[model samples]
Target chain A: MEPYPYTVNPFVHQDRFWYPFVSPFDPCPPIRAKRYVVPPNQFLGFQPPNLLQFPPAQALMKGTLWPALFSPYKKTGKVEIKDP
Target chain B: MWVYEKKLQYPVRVSQCNPTLAKYLIEQYGGADGELAAALRYLNQRYTLPDKVTGLLTDIGTEEFAHLEMIATMVYKLTKDATPEQLKEAGLGDHYADHDRALFYHNAAGNPFTATYIQAKGDPIADLYEDIAAEEKARATYQWLIDISDDPDINDGLKFLREREVVHSQRFREAVELIKEYNEQKNFF
Candidate 1:
């Protein structure tokens, strides 16, 4: 069976005076050539901001999956990597 | 455990105070398909997903948190120096009355954010499909915002975020494929 033919409207209309009345569905709207100028470089550091000062030896571990696979810190202290 | 970053994923500097635009942009900040909802949805769904998919969701969810911060920063800058008269003229009287110049978690129409904005279905396929739709919706909202905004700084930030949504959608589609392959293999046995 052929499906009913219908065209979709990519706009949403709002009746509120405060909000934008019409909104189009183009996620990346084309910017004007002159308006596409880049901002002045502030000479910020290239490296990511490391706000937390953790010890150099401490490895950051995230999520439970890794811990489930293997734990570096063992309760029995059998295979702990000692830093001499 | 998430680490605190002092910087935004994209810079947001609003040179002009446009209370009207600020009101509209608030939708993306805390709306149904907003970054906050996206972050929570993906993070919560990761628990039931397979290892690799869990990692994807975790990373994307973390990125969404940064996007949320960017949106909040834009909103704050827009409303920072706005006078009460200007806010009232911009039809932001009610919002100003409630929270003053401070940023509150609410949509354009002033509805507070709720957990019901997103669903964390245990099924991988269902969750991935939802994530894709969520990304598209967020992209559409950002488009609308970009269409109305004239400021170059705000537009640049919105453009970065809109592109991120598209990328997230593509990644979620790949995750869906992975789940389908896994299911096929499981059924063959």
Candidate 2:
């Protein structure tokens, strides 16, 4: 039997958009929606009890046992690879 | 005492031999925020830390060595087949002249790895914060390396490494909280 079998909080967001107020006298153009991350740890002030876990194979592949902690990163720059 | 694990923590299969990528990969292998620095820093800190979190440090430190091995595997596979001329063309001429395909502890800019890269302060908060910053920096480094490299296999390895940083950083943050709670308990006495 799978432990903590139900997928938990997978839809909970990790990335947050911080919209800086554009000043009229600013030298550069208004840059909106600067994407930033609120990593899993921040959401979890401390690791909570009975956390859902990935299966052994999936855990090794995801780089963590807890599914909440697996944050796939997308690089922010010239090359645009698809974000997970 | 640590037992030798023959298999890599994560599989590292290189699709092509790109010495340029190998050069970039060395930064993580030996640079300031690299795995070696991380392993040494955490392991050294473990001895002085409160007993509860000491095990965490040891566990993560040991894991960093696995990460270090995985990186070495990638670098070795990438550069193993490259000719001397090919290595030179990839901006490793200076390295080739000195080491000749042998791995040296140096950063992308050719700075040798030094003790200054790792710190073991007695203060738990300070050490944990340093660890947190190191993990974030390594995460960013992997992101940039992944950005510039085109090889899918190398990127797969880099992606795994990058995600590990996230896990480590999270653990360190939790450790900080754990230490703080311990301090509060100590104050009660």
Candidate 3:
């Protein structure tokens, strides 16, 4: 089953990608790009005054009153980590 | 002087019995990263913090207790009707033998809850940073719980809990900024 059928807009900027310095001599094939999380809160070192907020009902559903602060984590991609 | 609301902060719906899932959910119930640890950690830190920070801690700490109750509700509902054999099969045999359906403060692996799970550094900056980390950890826990959970009804509750962790983390971050500003002003004077 597809855990998340719909996609979130990448423009939302909730997450970021980084290109690791892969060694050509390494045994395993180096992956091109990797996704790393920079949660919404990370951008806001200090919350601004009077940010836009989700409606009360939607707020409860989203788990945050402010839309900017809500980082949706869907169960789709499997986490992959390589041992150094 | 806190008001007791009979209803849950979020509607918890556990559709069917699955003790295996319940066993995994116990990590958030009595685990080091669970709601009880969060509630106690923040509440204990509230006393020595700046007045503004203290109020925020109180608010978040109290909310964590409510979250704990919701976790407890789910655990209880999951295990309420299971037989000893069923529970034993679900890896809760020791829990059943010792506690017998009674909710014990222990992690998924059965390590009992201890005050050591929580920390109160007394300094606002340290405590708020710790609080933010704690909230993020709890959010990750909820995400893993949701990933493992196949029950939609249970997932709904877990989703709510996870989101609360996000909100709390942000609030603590803002509080950290506020406390820093407060300290700067104090130094200027």
Full-model lDDT for every candidate: 0.70, 0.84, 0.83
Per-residue lDDT tens digits for candidate 3, residues B95-143, read: 9889999999999999999999888887778888899999989888888
Off by over 4 Å in 3: A1-37, A76-84, B182-189
Better of 1 and 2 by lDDT: 2
Docking class of predicted structure 3: medium
Instruction: List candidate 2 segments past 4 Å from native.
Output: A1-12, A16-36, A77-84, B182-189
Q: DockQ numbers for every candidate?
A: 0.02, 0.54, 0.53
lDDT minimum window of 10 residues, candidate 1 chain B: B180-189
Which scores greater on TM-score, model 2 or model 3?
A: 2
Candidate 3: residue B134 lDDT (0-100):
93
Q: Which number leads on TM-score?
A: 2
Candidate 2's residue-wise lDDT over B55-128, tens digit each?
99999999999999999999999999999999999999999999999998889899999999988888888888
Candidate 3, lDDT over the whole model? 0.83
- Report, to 2 decimal places, the DockQ of model 1: 0.02
Clashing pairs for predicted structure model 3, backbone only: none
Clashing pairs in 1: none
When superposed on Cα atoms, how far off is each prediction in RMSD?
18.2, 6.3, 5.4
Best by lDDT: 2
Residue B75 miss distance in model 1 (angstroms): 0.3
